[model samples]
Target: MEKKQRMSRRSEQMGDQIEERIVTGVYPPGMRLDETELASGFGVSRTPVREALIQLASAGLVEIRPRRGAIVAEIGQHRLYEMFEVMAELEAMCGRLAARRITESEQRALVAAHQACEAARDANDPDAYYQRNERFHHLIYAASHNVFLEEQAAALHRRLRPYRRLQLRVRDRMGTSFSEHAGIVEAILAQDGELAATRIRTHVVVQGQRFADLIASLPMLGSPSLT
Candidate 1:
C-alpha cells in the first residue's frame, strides 16, 4: 500500500480503538483528548490521532474545540432521552418489520447469539456478554431488511454504547440483559409485530433508565469534565 493508504488504514484502526475505549467507558465522556498523548499511546504521529478525532467528531462521539482541544462529547439527560426516543422508534420499526420478514437463517443466527450471551452470563462475564448482546441486536437489525432503519439504529447504538456498557457494569446485569433478549427473540419468532415493536421499544427505554440509575449511584459518569 502507498503511504497515503497506510495512513488511512492506520487512522481507521486507531479510530476504532479509540471508539472502543470510548464505548467501553474506559475513556469516559467529556474527557479531553491530548493528540500527543494519543499519538504516543498508539505509536503513531499526531496526524493520525488528529484524523481519528475528526472521524469521531463527525460521528458525534467527540467535540473538537477551536484551541481548547478535542474532548469526548458531553451528553445531558434531555439529549440522552431524545436519543432513546428516536432509537426506540427505529428499533420498534425494525422489530415490526423483522417479525414479518425474518428468514430461517436469521432466526438461527439470532438464537445462537442469544445462546452466546447466555453462556457469557453464566460465566459471569459482563464484557463477553456485551459483545454477544451487540451481535444479537445487529442480527435483528439486519433481519429487518430496512436499510435506512438499520443505519439509523446502528448510529444510535453507537452513541449509546458507553452508557449501555455502564448499565451492564452493574452486578447481575448480564443475566437481566440475556433475559430481555430472550423475550425479544420469542416475540420476533411468534410473528407478533406489535408485541415485538413494543417489547423492543421498552427494552431500549429501560436501557436509558438503567443508564440514569448507574450515573446516580456511581456519579463518576456525569461528573467527568471536558477539560
Candidate 2:
C-alpha cells in the first residue's frame, strides 16, 4: 500500500508538470508528447510517465492514439467560441441566482475570494491570480445555493481552466480581470440580479476574446490556425 501510494504521488506530480507545460505553451497544441523522452526528462520509469499521459488525456488536454501516442489537444476557433458562449451564459445564471439568494456568510466568502485575487494581482502573479479567480467564481456558484447549477458550472469551469489561464498572459489582463470582478461583486452585493448577470456574462465573453488574441499572437501557433 505504501509503495502504491508513492507511485500515485509520483504520477500526480509528473502529470502536474506536463499539464503546466501544456497550459503555458511550453507544449503547444498539436505537439506530440513522446513517452520515452518524457520518461528520460522526468527521470522516472515509463510507468509513471504513461500514467501521467493517461490522466492528461482524461482532462481533454491530451489525445492518445494507438500509433501516435499522446498529442496535445487543439481547441479550434469555432469550438472555442461555442464553449465560451456556453460558459458565459452559465456564469451569468450563477451570478443572477447568487445575487438573489446569497447568505451573509456566502457574501463574505465571495469578498474574501475577490480580495485574494486582488492580492495576487498586486503581487504581479498571474498564476496566483488565476487560482484565486476560480475560487471567486466558485464561491459565487456556491452562493447560488443550487446544487445542480453549481455542479454543471464547476465541471465546465474545469474544462476551460487551461485556456482561461492562457488569457492572463495577455497584456494587463490580470488588472482588467480584477476590475471586472469589482463590478461583479458590487452588483451581487447590491442584490441587482440583472446587473450581476450582465456583468458576469460580459466578463466571461471578454475572456473568450482575450484567449483568441493570445492564441493568435503566439509565435509558435503563428496565426491561430484552428486544428
Candidate 3:
C-alpha cells in the first residue's frame, strides 16, 4: 500500500512538471509527448510517465489518441477567458465566506501564507511567489468552511494553475499580486465579507488591459519546440 501511494504521488508530481512545461511553451500545443522521453527526462520509469500522461489527458492538457500517443492540447484564448471569469466568481465566494467563518487559527495561517508571499516578492522570484501565492489562496478556501465550495474552487484552481503561473511571469506582476493579496488579507481579517469578495474578484479577474497582456504572453499554437 505504501509503495502504491508513493507511485501515485510520483505520478502526480510528474503530471505537474509536464503541465508546467506545456504552459511555458517548452512543450507547445500539438507537440508529441513520448512516454519514454518523459520518463528519461524525469529519471523515472515509463509506468509513472504513462500514468502522468493519463492524468494530464483527464485535465484536458494532453490528448491521447490511438496512434498519436499523448499530444499537448491547444487551449483557445476565449475558453481560457471563460474559465478565468468563472474562477473569479468562485474565488470571490470563497473570500466572502472566509471573512465570515474564519477562525483565529485559520486567520493566522492565512497571514503566514501572505507573509511568505511577501518574502518571495521581495526576493523578486516569481516562481517562489507562485508557490506561496497558491498557499495563501488555499488557506482562504479552507477558512470558508464550505467543503463543497472549497472542492469546486480547488478543482478550477488546479485547471487554471498553468495560466496563473504564466501570468506571474509578466513584468512587475509578482509585486502587484502581492499588493493585491495584502488588501484581501486585510478585508478578511476585518471580517468585511462584501469588501473581501470585491477585492478577491478584482484580484482574480483578468480584464481589459490585463486580459490583453495575458493573451499576448501566451505561447502561439503550433510553435516549434526542441522537446
Candidate 4:
C-alpha cells in the first residue's frame, strides 16, 4: 500500500511537471509525448509516466489517441476564455462560502498562504509566487466547507494552471495580484460574504488590458516534436 501510494504521488508530480512544460511550450501543442522518453527524463519507470499522461488526458491537457499514443492538447483562446469565465464564477462562489463558513484555524492557514505569496512577490519570483498563489486560493476553496464545490473548483483549477502561471509573468502582475489578494483576504477574514465574492471575482476575471496581456504573452504554437 505504501509503495502504491508513493507511485501515485510521483505520478501526480510528473503530471504537474509535464503540464508545466506543455504550457511553457517546452512540449508544444501537437507534440507527441513518448512514455519511455518521459520516464527517462523524469528518472522514473514507464508505469508512472503512463499514469501521469493519463491524468493529464483526464484534465484535457493531453490527448491519447489509439495509435498515436499521447499528444499535447491545444486550447484555443476563446475556449480558454470560456473556461476562465466559469472558473471565476466557481471561485467567487467559494469565496462567498468561505467567508461565511471558515473556521479560525482555516483563517490562520489562509493568512499564512497569503504571507507566503507576499514573500514570493517581494523576491520577484513568478515561479515561486505561482505555487504559493495556488495554495492561497486552494485554502479558500477548502474553507468553503463544501466538499462537492471544493472538488469542482480544484478540477477546474488544475485545467487552468498553466495559463494562470503564464499570466503571472506579465510586468508588475505579481504586485497587482498581491494587492488584489489583500482585498480578498480582508473581506474573507472580516466574514463579509458579498464583499469577498465581489473582490475574488474581480481578481480572477481577466478583462480588457489583462486579457490582452495574457494573450500576447502566450507561447507561440509550433510544430510537434518528440522531445
- Pick the lDDT winner: 4
Candidate 2 or 3, higher TM-score? Answer: 3
Q: If scored against the real structure, what TM-score would every candidate get?
A: 0.81, 0.84, 0.91, 0.90
- Model 2's TM-score against the true structure: 0.84
Q: What is the C-alpha RMSD of each candidate to the true structure, in Å?
A: 3.8, 2.9, 3.6, 3.6
Tens-place lDDT per residue, model 1, 113-169, is 999999989888877877888898888899999898898888888777656766787
Model 3 worst lDDT window (10 residues): 218-227
C-alpha lDDT values of all predictions: 0.81, 0.86, 0.89, 0.91
lDDT of 2: 0.86
Worst 10 residues of 4 by lDDT: 218-227
Clashing pairs in 3: none
Clashes of 1: 0
TM-score of 4: 0.90
User: Pairing residues by index, what is the TM-score of model 1?
Assistant: 0.81
lDDT of 4 by residue, 135-195 (tens): 9999999999999999999999988887899899999999999999999999999999999
Question: Tens digit of lDDT per residue, candidate 2, span 1-227?
Answer: 99999999999889878988887679988899999999999899999999999988977789998899999887666666677789999999999999999999998989999999999999999889998999999999998889999999988887777677778878898999999999999999999999999999999974445766865644333223564
